[model samples]
Every structure is written in C-alpha cells, then in structure tokens.
Target: MHDTTHHALQRQRRQVIWGLTLIAFGVAYLLQRDDGDAVVRLWQYWPWVLVAFGVNNMLPPTDGRRFVDGLSQVLFGAWFWITIEGWWGLNFGNSWPLLIIVGGLGMVLQPLAHRYFPRHQEERS
Candidate 1:
C-alpha cells in the first residue's frame, strides 16, 4: 500500500510538472510571435535544451545513470555555449579536450558515488 501511494504521488508530480511546462511554453510562444527578430535570434540559445536535459536528469531520486547523463548534459551545454555560441570565442578544436575531461571524470566518479551513496532499494521492490 505504501508503494502504491508513493507511485501515485510520483505520477501526480509528473503530471503537474508537464502541465506547467506546457503552459510556460505556450506563453513564451505567444510572447515571441510578435517579434520576428527575437524569434530569429532565439536559435542562438539552443544550448539551453541541453541544459534543460541536464537539469531533468539531476531531478529528485537521482541515481548512477541519471548522474552520468546529467553530467554529460551539463558538459555538452557548456561546450555548446563556448564553441557553437562563441561565448568566449573558443575554437572547437581547442575545446575538444574539455569533453574528454568531463567523460573521464564521469567514468571515474560514477562507481565511487554509487558505492558510497547508493539509491534506496525500496523503489525496486
């Protein structure tokens, strides 16, 4: 019974979040429709999508997989901002090493984190 209640609560939370996100997007769409230049310039903020993904992965009940995915998203978002968006005029060739570093860190830390801070096994039951 407790698990059932927990599952129901999780479902409710997800529904609420989805509904709010849709409403927010609707508002943003309406607000941007009147400004042609703003709409066009919006493409430059594409890295935000990666950031959003990263945030989603880091949301509550985080685990090893989510941690790795979140880390990748954050790293990708930063790389996109620096190289694609040219935030600091960084070159892709020079920035490739950053990707390597992030990936290596994720690989090294994930096991240790999972070992030390394992998620509760109750959800699995």
Candidate 2:
C-alpha cells in the first residue's frame, strides 16, 4: 500500500511538471507567432528552468540529499540570473566563486538535513 501510494504521488508529480512544461511551450509558441522579439526576450529567462527543476526536486517526500541538491540548483540559478542581468555589478568574472560556495554549503547542509529530518521509507509491496 505504501509503495502504491508513493508511485501514485510520483506519477502525479510527473504529470503536473509535464503539464506546466507544455503550457509554457504553448505560450512561447504563441508569443513567437505574435512577436519574434518577445520570444527572444523570453529566452533570456532560461535560468528559471533550473530554479523550477530545483523546486521540483525539493517537493514533498524527497530525501535530504535531493533537497540539498535542489537548494543548490535554485541558488545557482538565481545567482546566474542575477549575474547575467548585471545586478549589483555582478558578472560571470566576479560571481563565479558563488557556484563553489553554493556547492560547499549544500555538502554541509545535506548531512545535517538528513540527521534532523530523515527520509521517509516506503515499504516494499
């Protein structure tokens, strides 16, 4: 029963992710048809994809490792996006160290997260 529930939840998560992806694609397509420049501008937001994937990984029932991985991805994506936008004078040249920082933080946090909020074990059917 636990296995079944886990599988069902996984399936539902996949469906939701795919559905949102399709909708995004459809919107992009419509925007492309209406104004090519709009689509080009939209392409600049690609970093959000990484953030979205990170959020997905951190979804409910995920293990500490996955959560940490997701958190790193989210941080990296946001940092990259900010760099690209030149926010606060940040650029690839100066901001590259942040990637390493985020990785180190994730490594440290993953063990602590696991120790405190252990993963849920699904029983075998």
Candidate 3:
C-alpha cells in the first residue's frame, strides 16, 4: 500500500527536478560577467545548498515520530539557507525560495519514508 505512494512521490520529484535546469542557465549568465562579488558569493554558499540537497535525498526510512521531531528541531535545506543568509545580513533575494523548497522537500520525504517504511513490529492488540 505505502510502497505505491512512495514510488509515486519519487516519480513526482524526478519530474520537478527539471526546474533546476534554469538554475544552471542563470549561473552561467552570472559567471560570464566574472564579477568578483558574484563569483565569491556563489562559491561561498553553493556548498551549503548542495549539502542540504544531499541530506534530503538520503533521509532514512523511520518512524514518522522521529522524522517529524527531527525536521521540526533542525532546519535543513531552505531553512539553513535563510539562517546563513540572515546571519551574514544578506537580504535573501532569489535564493529565498530554495529554503522553502529544500526544507519542504524534507517534510515531504519524512512522510514518504514513514509511509513506505513504518517502524516494523509485532502486531499489538
């Protein structure tokens, strides 16, 4: 039952991943200018974004309680993006949406993980 939902969600994400094509195109334009500020900023925060993305993909199948608890306590992806930007006092501009997108993806993953892989146990009466 749950496996079907999980597979469907993964398929949906695979489709939405196309949106990132625009990111590459935009970056190419920025780098073409070769502005030092643009280049340095790109190098600085890009890794964090990548890390968030990786974590999102690898979120494990676990009890929904653990998943919800962790996500609520720690902000990854877009949440981290906003925190880093705010700490540096940079007005979050275009990248602001990434935070929600990334963070929300984790939320999405949590349910999917739980739906697909709920904690296994003996049936309780």
Specify the highest-TM-score model's number. 2
Candidate 1, residues 12-98, lDDT tens digits: the string is 655765676667666776789988887777666667667766766666556566667787898888788889766666778778888
Estimated TM-score for each candidate: 0.68, 0.82, 0.36
Please identify which of the two predictions, 1 or 2, would achieve the higher lDDT against the true structure. 2
Clashes of each: 0, 0, 1
Give candidate 3 misplaced runs (Cα > 4 Å).
Answer: 18-25, 28-32, 47-74, 78-125
Q: Between candidates 1 and 3, which one is better according to TM-score?
A: 1
Root-mean-square deviation of each candidate, in angstroms?
Answer: 3.6, 2.7, 9.5
Ranking by lDDT: 2, 1, 3
Question: What lDDT does the true structure give each of the candidates?
Answer: 0.70, 0.79, 0.51
lDDT of 3 by residue, 1-125 (tens): 25456556645654554456457647755665667666556544553544434443445532454455445434553345555567655445645665566567766777565675454211110
lDDT of 2 by residue, 1-125 (tens): 35567567767876787688779977887868878778777767878878887888788767677779889989988997998899999999999998889989998998787775453432331
In model 1, pairs of residues that clash are: none
- Give the TM-score comparing model 1 with the true structure, all chains together: 0.68
Candidate 2 vs 3: which has more lDDT = 2
